[model samples]
Target: MSQVMKPSTAAQKLGILLSAAPEDFQQTPISREDLDALRENPPQWLQDLRRNGPFPRDVIAQKLGVSNSGLARGGLTDPLDADQIGELLANPPQWLEHERSVHRKVVAENERLKAERARQGN
Candidate 1:
C-alpha cells in the first residue's frame, strides 16, 4: 500500500530544497577589487554615455539600485568637480559610504599626482 508523507517531514524537505536552490540566493555586496577594476576600466557603454555629459544622477542612481544622493556622493555619475567631491567626502550617503571611500582614495591619488606634476613644472 502507498503511504502518505508526514506534514512536518514534507515541510522539512521543502525547506531543504528551497535552501539548496541557487535562485533563492541573496545578493552580496560588491568587492573592493571589483570596484577598483571598474574605476580603472569603465565599460564601453558607460564611456559612451558619459561622453554626452553626466547621465542624470537620479537615473544612473536608479540603474545602480541606489539612491540619487548616494550616486551623487559616490562620484559614480560623471565629471564631478572639486566642490562636489568635497561635499561628498565630507558627508556621504549611507548606502554607498564604503564605495565612496574607495572613490575618495582614487581622487586623492589623482590630486596628489596633479600637485606633484605642478610642482615639477610639467
Candidate 2:
C-alpha cells in the first residue's frame, strides 16, 4: 500500500532538503558606484568599432590578395580601408571555417576513442 502525497507537502519537503546546505550558498552583488563610474566614462569610439558593420568590400578583397572586382563578384562589397584589410587578412573567415572543421574532426575522434575504451572496460 502507498500513500499519495499532496503537492504542497512535497514542495515543503523539497524546500527543506534544498535549505539544508547553508555552506553552499553564495552572493554576488554589483556595486552601484562601479556602474555609475562606467556610465560616466564610457568606452572610446575606436575601442567600440565592431559596432559598425563589416569592413568595406575593397579592403576585404585587398586583404584576401584578390582584385576588388573579384571580391565584388563573390558578394563581399563592405568597403573596408587598408588597415581593416590587413586585419581581415590576418584573421580571415575561411581560416576560421577550416579551424572549426578541424576541431569537429578532433572531437569526433575523441568521442570514438571514448566509446571504444568504454567497450573494452578501460
Q: Which residue runs of candidate 2 sit more than 4 Å off their true CA positions?
A: 1-92
Residue-level lDDT tens digits of model 2 in 4-86? 44433332332222122122221222244433443466344322332342444433443465555556555564555446556
Model 1, position 8: C-alpha lDDT score: 31
Error of 1 at 79 (Å): 17
Instruction: List the lowest-lDDT window of 10 residues for candidate 2.
Output: 17-26
Model 1, runs deviating above 4 Å: 1-55, 58-95
TM-score of predicted structure 1:
0.27
